[model samples]
Target: MFYWFLKWVALGPLLRVVFRPQAEGLENIPTDGPAILASNHLSYADWLFMPLTLPRRVSFVAKAEYFTAPGLKGWFQKTFFSGSGQIPIDRSGANAAEGALISAKGVLGKGELFGIYPEGTRSHDGRLYRGKTGVARLALETGVPVIPVAVVGTDVVAPPGKKFGKVTRPQVRFGKPLDFSRYEGLENDRYILRSVTDEIMYEIMTLSGQEYVDMYATRAKAEAKQAEREAAAEKKAS
Candidate 1:
């Protein structure tokens, strides 16, 4: 009820008008039952644009920081994310991966559409990074078909810290459902998990047309921050 209300009454119309997203292969999404919507993370706008285009309620696993923000901005973030049915996951420590898997399994068990960005974090350089194997684990464990989705042009809408930029149209492409049921009962097999994750990433790459990186997005983000700090120190010394 609140989901539809928020979509049609508040967010849906506004986003459609602003982003002017072009979606394809939406029919690939099953009308009912559980499925995983795996996508590549490009920008913060990817969160807004991707869910808005989906006809069904797709719940994503968002970081816990979004829920703990302060002041009015924090309130809005918490409210919007909550209303959108996003699950909050604490991405800290060695247990974080296990915790996320538990949350995802719960969502899938309830016959819901679970949305996940296998890259673990947004791509700072607009290039698709190697996907984490969590997605494959979820699909293999839950026996849910994975739908590869791609969102293009969101990087232009809101890239990194620069928000409220020029309004550029976005495009979302949903690929056919991928079944990894053949690898059933093989969740413990690391080789199978990597193979499945790579296959899904390949499909996302085809849809988004971004260069694939062998490294993880988290690593790339760390490198970017280090470079920024070094540059700042150099300027200070000069």
Candidate 2:
């Protein structure tokens, strides 16, 4: 109810008018059954822009921090994120990835659309990072087709470190679903998981046309923050 209200009543119409999103291959999404929408993470706006174009209700796993924020800001974050059909996953420690996989599988088992940013985190430099194998593991475990989606121009709408920005048009493209039924029983094979994840990432790369980076986005973000800190210290000394 809340999801529809927001999509049809509030944010959807406004975003469409502003972003003028160009969506493609939406038919590739199955009307029924479980499927994973695997996409490249470009910016924070990628979360809102991708789903805004989709006709069906798609749920994505979000960081737990968004739900646990303090004060009125926390209340707003919780309401907004929860109403948008996002599931909160604690992204910490060795068990975090496994926990996310469990939650994704639960969603898929219920025959719902599961959206995952295979890169694990938003790209700091607009380059598609190597995908973690959790996506592949989910697909293999659930026997669901993985749809490759690309979101363009969202980085401009909301760049990293900026609370808000001038409203700009963004585009979203969905690629044909990739079926890995051939590897139905190979979910436990690490080599197979790696191969499948690479293939999915390749399709996303083609759709988004972003440069591929082999490193994870989280690592890149840490490095970027370190650089900013060092620069600030240098400026202070000077």
Candidate 3:
């Protein structure tokens, strides 16, 4: 399949030589069967470099834009993203979050690795943001173990809102698989969902060593922008 081709034959080897990515706790990933890889959202490259270290294919949901571009370049991009295990999801709808969970659950049901960012969005700053509870729901609904993974230094490889940056090596760390079976059949309980999500975030915090911010990244960004506007208005009045 194209996934294996990219992972082992061409792209993987070239990336290994270029980035020289380092990985730890590889033993935590199951050699076979289904598992949820709940990781912190550092940068777009987090998906790339993390999966580069794994022998099994890890699929992540991506915006449909990546596959909808036109022209020859778009064709190549579509092929590459598709081959690299990025599934296109229509994230424009109100039920986008629920849809993503369904897509992830399908992958897990197939006994394949499904990667998700618990933070929902890439952190605007380098610090780790509070994770969304959808990951916990997926884990509970699918009965798959959640592995807290940290892809450090990827923000440098490709910053959140910019093009590729420096060529520094990115480190991928994997924590022990977290079992949440005790909370079985409680997926609908919002309180239980938050608790499980927090536990996963804690493990990611340890692995990533980034400052923990209790606010969601989107809200923080919005608030910061509002503050900036207020400051500008005050300056203008002066």
Candidate 4:
């Protein structure tokens, strides 16, 4: 209800006019079935442009903080996120991964589309990071095909640490669905999970054309921040 209203009536139209997003290979997404949209996280705009371009509603598992902040700002945040077809899951605890999978599976159970960032977080640099195995686990466990999605130019439109971006069109390319049903029941096998995840990441890398980094996005961000802090401290002592 709110999702439809927000998308068709409010944000979707506004975003289309602003960014002019275009999607390719949208036919690959099943109009009525479960599938995982495995994408490389670039910017916050990645989420917006995806749903704005797709006809069917796509649901993303977002951080719980987006739904639990305080004050009027929190109310707006909660309303926007909820209305945009996002589900909140606490990602701070050790069991966060498990909880997210459960939430995602529930969405799949209803034969709906679910979106996931295989890198687990937005890429701090413009490189494709090694994907986490959660996506593979979800695909294998549910026996659903995984569609590799490449979202381009969103970083330029809405780069990290910025509230607004320049007026530029973004491109969304969808690859064919990847079937890993042959590896069914092997979701618990760590090696198999890594292999499956790497395969999906390979497709996303090909589509996005980002340099493949063999590290997680979160780790890369931390390292970049540390380097910045060290450089600042060194300059201060000079």
Best by TM-score: 4
Error of 1 at 40 (Å): 0.8
Consecutive 10-residue window with the lowest summed lDDT within model 1: 158-167
Q: Evaluate model 1: give its lDDT.
A: 0.89
Clash number for model 2? 0
Give the Cα-based TM-score of candidate 1 against the true structure. 0.92
TM-scores for the candidates: 0.92, 0.91, 0.95, 0.96
In candidate 1, stretches whose alpha carbon ends up further than 4 angstroms from where it belongs are: 68-76, 231-238
The TM-score of predicted model 2 comes to 0.91
Candidate 1: residue 55 lDDT (0-100):
74
Model 1, 31-134: lDDT tens per residue?
A: 88999999988788787778787777888878899899999999999988888888898987688888889988888898989999999888888999999999
Question: 1 or 4, which is superior by TM-score?
Answer: 4
> Model 1: how far is 148 from its true place, Å?
0.7
Candidate 4 local distance difference test against the native? 0.93
Each prediction's whole-model lDDT (CA): 0.89, 0.89, 0.92, 0.93
lDDT by residue for model 3 over 1-238, one digit each (tens)?
9889888899889989999999999999999999999898878888889999998999999998899999999999999999998888889999988888888988998999999998888987899999999999999998899999998889998986788889999999999999999999999999999999999999999999999999998999899889999999999999
Q: Which whole-number lDDT from 0 to 100 does residue 39 have in model 1?
A: 95
Per-residue C-alpha lDDT of model 4 across residues 1-238, encoded as one tens digit per residue: 9989999998788888877899999999898999999999999889999878888989999999999999999999999999888999998899999999999999999999999999998887789999999999999999999999999999998788887778899999999999998998898999999999999999999998999999988899999999999999999999
lDDT of 2 at 178: 94
The local lDDT score (0 to 100) that residue 162 gets in candidate 2 is 81
Candidate 3 clash pair list: none
Between prediction 3 and prediction 4, the one with superior TM-score is 4
